[model samples]
Target: MTASKISFACAPVIALLGMAWGIAMAISTDHSTAPVHAHLNLLGWVSLFLMGIYYKLHEEIDGLFLARIQAIIWAAASLLIALGIALIHMNNPVGDPIAAVMSIVLFLDMILFVVLVAKSRQ
Candidate 1:
């Protein structure tokens, strides 16, 4: 499947998950994991969906290897960071390291995305 296709498919699923998580938090009256929910929605849903739209509009870069790599990395890092943050909020010290590493990975992935967008023909 094309990178755009993957993005389109994954974005909504992650959004649904984020929405469900938010509802659960609200019902429980515990917003400690709000950061995780926000990250999941922003990075997993919003960012991926936007990138998918960009790829759809720019056919030239839709199937580029770097674009595909960026999409995959974005999804993975987003999930990992959310997981790490969730764990940290639950009092797991290990999540600190996990989140720290994923944060750097996510930042580097965004840099790659910026380069891809800058170099796109359309």
Candidate 2:
């Protein structure tokens, strides 16, 4: 399958994991990781799935190398955000910086995605 398809396929899996994590947090009465869980579901699952749909609907987007780059950045940033939040929830000193960096990366990734889409339509 194409990278776009792969990215889309990952959404539900991430969502399920996020749901499980939320349930675990609820059971444990710990909402400390709620930010990470929300990000996983929104950015990791929803955004990626939307990107995939865009690529699927517009074949021209699939031809752009930026599509692959966007997928890579999205996946990597999602992991970093999740990991960073988990670390912060556990009171790790390095977590804040990592999450901050990943937040910037996520913004840039979205910018790149927008550029790719705009270019594809031209």
Candidate 3:
């Protein structure tokens, strides 16, 4: 399938994963768990697959640029999740700071992606 189509496919998967995460979080009543669970859906299953489609559809974007941005997403997401989890599990690790940085990076990446896609349509 084309990359853009992959994005559509991934969106729901990510959403569903999000739901699962919510369910797990709700059922367990345990406040101390690794935040990796959130990232698993947000980055791994959701972002990876969604971005696959975004890149596929927004064919105008530089493949290399998108790939690089995606790599950054994965790195940041994973890092943030790891740190967040640590923080959640009773550690004051650099969780919030790291997650915040990654969130900003993700925003930048999305903006860049949108720009490239728009330019490509021209």
Off by over 4 Å in 3: 1-35
User: Please, what are the lDDT tens digits per residue for candidate 2 over residues 1-122?
Assistant: 55577687777788887788899989999897899889888888888888888888778777567787788779778878988998999999899999999999999998998888787765
- The Cα local distance difference test for each model comes to 0.92, 0.83, 0.59
Greater lDDT among 1 and 3 belongs to: 1
Off by over 4 Å in 2: none
Identify the candidate with maximal lDDT: 1
Give the TM-score (vs. native) of candidate 1.
Answer: 0.96
TM-score, predicted candidate 2 vs. hidden true structure:
0.90
Clashing pairs in 3: 3-53, 3-56, 4-56, 4-57, 6-53, 7-53, 35-85
- Window of ten residues with lowest summed lDDT in model 2: 1-10
How do all the candidates rank in terms of lDDT, highest first?
A: 1, 2, 3
Query: What does candidate 1 score in Cα RMSD to the true structure?
Result: 0.9
lDDT string for model 3 (20-95, tens) is 7667777997745535566656665666665665666656563555555554555445445545655756567576
Best by TM-score: 1
User: What total of clashing residue pairs does each candidate reach?
Assistant: 0, 0, 7
Candidate 1 ranges with C-alpha deviation above 4 Å: none
What CA RMSD would you report for each candidate? Answer: 0.9, 1.5, 4.9
